[model samples]
Target: MNGMKIQITAELLDGLVLAILKQDDYYGYALTQRVQSVIDISESTMYPVLRRLKKNGDLTTYDQPFQGRNRRYYQLTAAGEQRLQEILRLWEQYKDNLDQIFYQRGEQQ
Candidate 1:
């Protein structure tokens, strides 16, 4: 059986994309694929989230030609980058708290 995977909540996914864009600009399909590799999710499901992020002023997109086709790519705005960092910090703190809870409760069966 696969080990218990960390649940990638919707909010977490928003944060994840911003964090990834920090590394490099990526098209929607590429982002969907990359995110799915880490957590099982569909491209269709990803689009709305991306759209919402864009609407919220956290993402900016552009098109680039690659060989024969133009791909639409997304990048984190300064606001998005700052938001990602803040979310990461909070996640880390929450994780520490959860770890303490788990340890206090003892290992699962």
Candidate 2:
């Protein structure tokens, strides 16, 4: 499992970004760090996801001054919240199906 590569799809990436933004707004670097903490992803991979979400109208951005520089912050829109809900619903269904298979196998053996 240590060396196994789990592919993170774009949909999952979008959901993760939206979910993080659902809690509170975050600057680009901070958001990347948060997502990276959960899974192995590069900053290069993260920026495109952010761009896509923003293009899809699921996210909005603003700039705030920090340390004499403006840091761009991302916030979830109403649409983003809706997207997150849908993703959560789908994820639950997928998890449940996998759980059934795993647990049922355990019970059979």
Local accuracy of candidate 1 as per-residue lDDT tens digits, 14-108? 98888888999999999999888778788899999999988988899999999999999998999898889888998998788888787775465
Candidate 2 local lDDT, 1-109, one digit each (tens): 2688888888888889999999999999999999988889999999989988999999999999999999999999999999999999998987888898978843564
List where candidate 1 sits over 4 angstroms from the true fold. Answer: 1-6, 105-109
Note the Cα lDDT for every prediction shown.
0.88, 0.91
Model 1 TM-score (2 dp): 0.85
RMSD, each candidate, Å? 3.7, 2.4
Q: How many backbone clashes does candidate 2 have?
A: 0
Deviation in angstroms for 36 in model 2?
0.6
Q: Which parts of model 2 have CA positions greater than 4 angstroms off?
A: 1-3, 105-109
TM per prediction:
0.85, 0.91
